[model samples]
Target chain A: GAGVSQSPSNKVTEKGKDVELRCDPISGHTALYWYRQSLGQGLEFLIYFQGNSAPDKSGLPSDRFSAERTGGSVSTLTIQRTQQEDSAVYLCASSPNPVYEQYFGPGTRLTVT
Target chain B: AQRVTQPEKLLSVFKGAPVELKCNYSYSGSPELFWYVQYSRQRLQLLLRHISRESIKGFTADLNKGETSFHLKKPFAQEEDSAMYYCALKGFGNEKLTFGTGTRLTIIP
Candidate 1:
């Protein structure tokens, strides 16, 4: 079966620029998650979506970070006015349910220079 | 606040030797504990979960509420086991997971 997939394996941008990262969850998966991996913070949860309910954005580091899942399938994470600190590997994952095991994507490495 | 901690940044053991990767977590309520592994050039994947009480790839972990710990153990190490291991916790009814910094285990042949 196809696993979760992310776009733009690597991205390099200047500070203050905006970037959009896309994620395509596995078919029939109702739960989607966005996480960030960096040298300083390790792995940190960014946001999560479950069905049509409200998304969980508690883990977003700042107001500049936002994400939206459409049609209960594809998700896009947007970071506005990116800072050097925002440089990290953005990973996406999906699960059949909240309690089930999650499958991860190859991740997009974002570099803010 | 929920948190997971992996004390060791890196651990090395010879093949056929016993290995233990320590993990401790702090949460207000009962939490679901999991071990995720990532091999070189591979995406992170679930290695085992405490609730399942089943071993995967010869790895096992036990949840100890009293100590607030869930440590991964293997009786015999293999070179293939060399990879990054992360301990994670999800609070009851919560969708987000708190993850540890991760431990890089290297099995020497």
Candidate 2:
């Protein structure tokens, strides 16, 4: 079975720019999540989607961060007006349901200069 | 606020030695605890969960509610056991996990 896959494994952008990271979850997973891993901060949850709608976006650091899932499959995380502090590995994970074990993607390493 | 803490940032142990990666979490309600591991160049994956009570790769974690801890332990550490370990907690029915700071375990050959 194919696992979760993320595109653009690495991205480098200047400050104030915007970037979009894509995530393709497992074939039948109904839940998807995004997280950021930065030095010392560990892995910080960003947003989660149950089906096509996100029930929890509280973890999103600011309005500059947003996500959308279409057709109940592919998801995209967009960071607008990126800052140097945003340099981190953006990870995507998918689960069979709301309570199943999660399978993660390789993650997109985003560098904001 | 839910929080997970891995007290040691790094731990080193010789092969065949017992190993323990300490993890403590703070949450208001009963939570499901899990241990996740990431080998070099690999994506993070689940190692074990308190609910399953199953050991993976000779490692186990026990969730202690009274102490709010879920420490991962292995009786005999192997060189291949070296990796970054993260302790996570999930609210009942809420799949989102709060991960610990992580511990880098080095098993010397």
True contacts kept of 2: 0.82
Chain B of candidate 2 vs. true chain B, TM: 0.96
Which pairs clash in model 1? none
> Which stretches in model 1 have alpha-carbon errors above 4 Å?
none
Q: What is the TM-score of chain A in candidate 2?
A: 0.96
Report the C-alpha lDDT of model 1 over A7-88, residue by residue, as the tens digit. 9899999999999999999999999999999995558999999999999999899999999999999999999999999999
Cα TM-score per model: 0.98, 0.98
Candidate 2: CAPRI quality band: high
Task: Give DockQ per model, in order.
Answer: 0.81, 0.86
Report the C-alpha lDDT of model 2 over B1-109, residue by residue, as the tens digit: 8999999999999999999999999999999998999999999999999999998988988888899999999999999999999999998766689999899999999
The lDDT, on a scale of 0 to 1, for candidate 1 is 0.95
Give the whole-model CA lDDT for all candidates, comma-separated.
Answer: 0.95, 0.93
